[model samples]
Target: MDLPHFSILISDKQYRKLNRNIWSEKPVEAELQIEDKTFDVDLLYRGNHVREFSKKSYHCIFPEITAGIKEIHYNAEFMDKSLMRNKLSLDFFSSIGVLSPTAKHVLLSINEENQGVYLQLESVDRNFLKRRKLPSGPIYYAENDDANFSLHSPIDEDIKDSFDSGYSRKEGSSRDDKTLQELIYKINTLKKTEFERAILDYINIDKYLRWLAGVVCTQNFDGFIHNYALYRNSFTGLFEMIPWDYDATWGQDINGEEMEFDYIPIEGYNTLTARLLDVPTFRKQYAKIFEEILTYHFNKQNLYEKINVMHNTLRPHVLRDPYVAKFIDDFDREPGIILKFIDDRHHYLRNHLQDLR
Candidate 1:
């Protein structure tokens, strides 16, 4: 009736049901179902494979090709180039120990008016979770699901324990001081492991947390821990930190009243695993990365410059283009509506490290 909006058509790829890894299934390519037409599409994996191509329960019917898309390279009217630049700029800067990712070159397939930019990549190897294991006993406690702190209305600790512990026949150790100590040990062990040694790309996750501090106090950004985490390679169990989703990042007027704020940390230099950093190790390693950033694409000055450039670049054109005008109008009018969270998101990134100097 209403043009059917956007949808997705999956290629016959035999991917693992649990995780979205490239498995041996003699897979075909994916197609995009926009309205009634289907267009050929390529797969772009970001952060972890968990959400890659995973059908969202709500939007599973009329699937949008852009749904759950983290990073991609394309020549779409105004997409890829802009979005990719934002992502990769942060990413590249991140690799250099900046609180972002480094920019990988864009591979373009251009002709006249349509130049397709595909293949956005960098040398930062992916990593997976560490120290994950089968539950030994009851895991959650009655208090773990505090109403004041719960975000997703996590099932009560008893129910969670029951399901996790095969109907609560046994129990997992409590997160006592000893348990916390064990977690600390396990985290440290992984940090110095041969697996981690290989990824000595100088990941200062602490820096990102530090950046979040500004987001909290100044930007009032409601950044959360669960929103960001460390990634790891499945085979090797190495940890690579990433700050993926930021839809609910920018906060509005609040007296810092959210209990979740208390439960989940939004500041302080730390690890993706919520580990407090070794002060000396953290500073030395981070400084090395910062210097490396200076030696390369890590440009703090360039970040602010880029933001100012975008405001100017998009302003004149958006004035003439109805689509762009609407995009901005909707963002301002509803304030964090339409594209949902991108406006507040851009605000945070655009103004994140401005006070660094």
Candidate 2:
């Protein structure tokens, strides 16, 4: 099936301004045409280091266009040869009942020039919470730089202060550092036994375990440290982990290197995971969750079928994508790599989880 089409119309002057300093957060006026409808939007170049690349990502705000749906993201997926990595990973998370931003493949054009096929992702903002029926709570994007869940700053530091520590609050009225600072304090100061109890008290353990399983199965090393969101559910009074920026997953590292199946540990990385594994109960639970994922969702056959469908859908557009076609030698071979990674990763995890148990 052909993917949906989205066209952004901007003046030559505005387009030049946007490309002049790609790192700028300056919003340029544009008209977004989706299907048969047109809406006015403010388009801005997004991404930390990706700004330096030719294939640029964008953040669009439909101020006078729509309600509830205020913003959307267009990810370039420049490093990925297959170009289906992010969409597939997010679909996998959703299939396993994880709350993640919705994504779809789209044939994108800027002004009248064909930009290429881009993954259009739903913004993980208040609209996300409303659509998912999740409780309204503070949402913080774990910034790409310092997303490590560690207590590196003083508790007294104003929550409003921008620290290179990499935490950016997206929602919530009171922007004081108290809520997050308290959580960090608890994570750092609490004893092992106390931490086990406190972590369970503050975060949803089952959801976290499932998220950890997804991260391990996908081999998303970057996700462990960054490119995720931690939201405190008002009703449950516990934080839930949300997946983000999965374009580099499925046997590839951040630098586009081919990753080995045995790279990531079954216990996972980060202090929170380390502390959780320290507890006997949490370890057993993790082992069980890992096994369940392999048996039910993370198997080679299920993944291969999904990959085949996406490959078939995207083959035409990928071949025509100017940016991707220039860099990738053989787009046909990309699906095989993902299939092999699934086979190898599943086999490795089966044995690894057994050893852990």
Candidate 3:
């Protein structure tokens, strides 16, 4: 299957500038070509550690393009041998009712040089909500562990300087930050009774639980405290989640090493999850979500079909990829790895469901 091809043309000066400051967030002027059309764009390196990889990821802002999208991300997925984990994980989240970013595989070319297959991800911003016909709201990215909904730093366990320490505002205003700050404060400072009553007003518990289930089932070790976006729904006045940077999922750790299916606890990590699960009613709701997903969505038989399709589609591409071509053998075995993880993870969670009961 031929994927959509994107060609980027940049001047030598701009290209040199990008390479000189590879770690910088500054975008250089570029022309992006899709099919027969060309549009001016701002292109820059994206991602944290992955930015340093030989096959770097990219962020592109289409100033002149009008496809109801302002920006797009091209993930190198350097650590993920299969290169399908991000899209697969996001698809699973969506299937289980979590509003994760949409992703697709596409071929990229820079200066007419083939850059191989890249996972083109939808940017989780205002446009994300708009496209889904969801209510417009303030969106913030959980950039690190401080986004853990605690007043302490996850790294050092020290009291945080601010309530919104781990988050970067992607959209919204100071008012949105106040709402997030208030939520964090209440989660940490409010007593048991007050918290139980006020928590529902601030967060969409059902959506959070489903997102937790998705994370646990997929086994994203770093997903709990970060790798997500928070959107405050205007109408509901409650915060919801959107997953991001899910390349290290489905039986693999962040380094693409094999991970035990039961590596992540069924309850998930993070203070918000801990506080929510502490409430008996919320725990039961979360347990029910786990049961439902395990019974229907997270099973090997059901997920293997999707896995096979993705694996087969990317197999040919992987063989030809410049960065991942050498790892084709590893890529070939990923379906089995993912499927086994699902089977084992399903068994583990079902047995542990009694804990919630």
Best by lDDT: 3
Query: Which RMSD does model 3 reach against the true structure?
Result: 1.0
Lowest lDDT 10-mer window, candidate 1?
53-62
Global local distance difference test of model 1: 0.31
Model 2: lDDT of residue 185: 65
Query: Compared with the true structure, what per-residue lDDT tens digits does model 2 show for residues 57-83?
Result: 899999843857989899998878888
Enumerate residue pairs that collide in model 2.
none
The superposed Cα distance between candidate 2 and the true structure at residue 295, in angstroms, equals 0.4
Number of the candidate with higher lDDT, 1 or 3:
3
Order of quality (TM-score)? 3, 2, 1
Q: How many angstroms is residue 218 displaced in model 1 relative to the true structure, after the best TM-score fit?
A: 11
User: How does candidate 3 score on lDDT?
Assistant: 0.89
Better of 1 and 2 by TM-score: 2
Candidate 1, residues 182-264, lDDT tens digits: the string is: 33234434554432443233233445434433333222232332333333223332223334322222232222122222222
Residue-level lDDT tens digits of model 3 in 1-357: 878899989999999999998888888999889999988999999988887899989899988536888999999999988788899999999999999888999999999998999999999888888999989989999888888888889778999999899999988999889999989999988887788889999999999999998988888888988899999999999999888999889888887788887788888888888888999899999999989999889899998889899888888877778888988888888888888888988899999999888
Misplaced by over 4 Å in model 1 are 1-37, 40-224, 234-236, 247-276, 287-300, 316-357
Alpha-carbon deviation at 15 in model 3, angstroms: 0.7
Decreasing lDDT order of the candidates: 3, 2, 1
Could you tell me how far off, in angstroms, the CA of residue 335 lies in candidate 3 after the best superposition? 0.8
Score every model by TM-score. Answer: 0.36, 0.93, 0.98
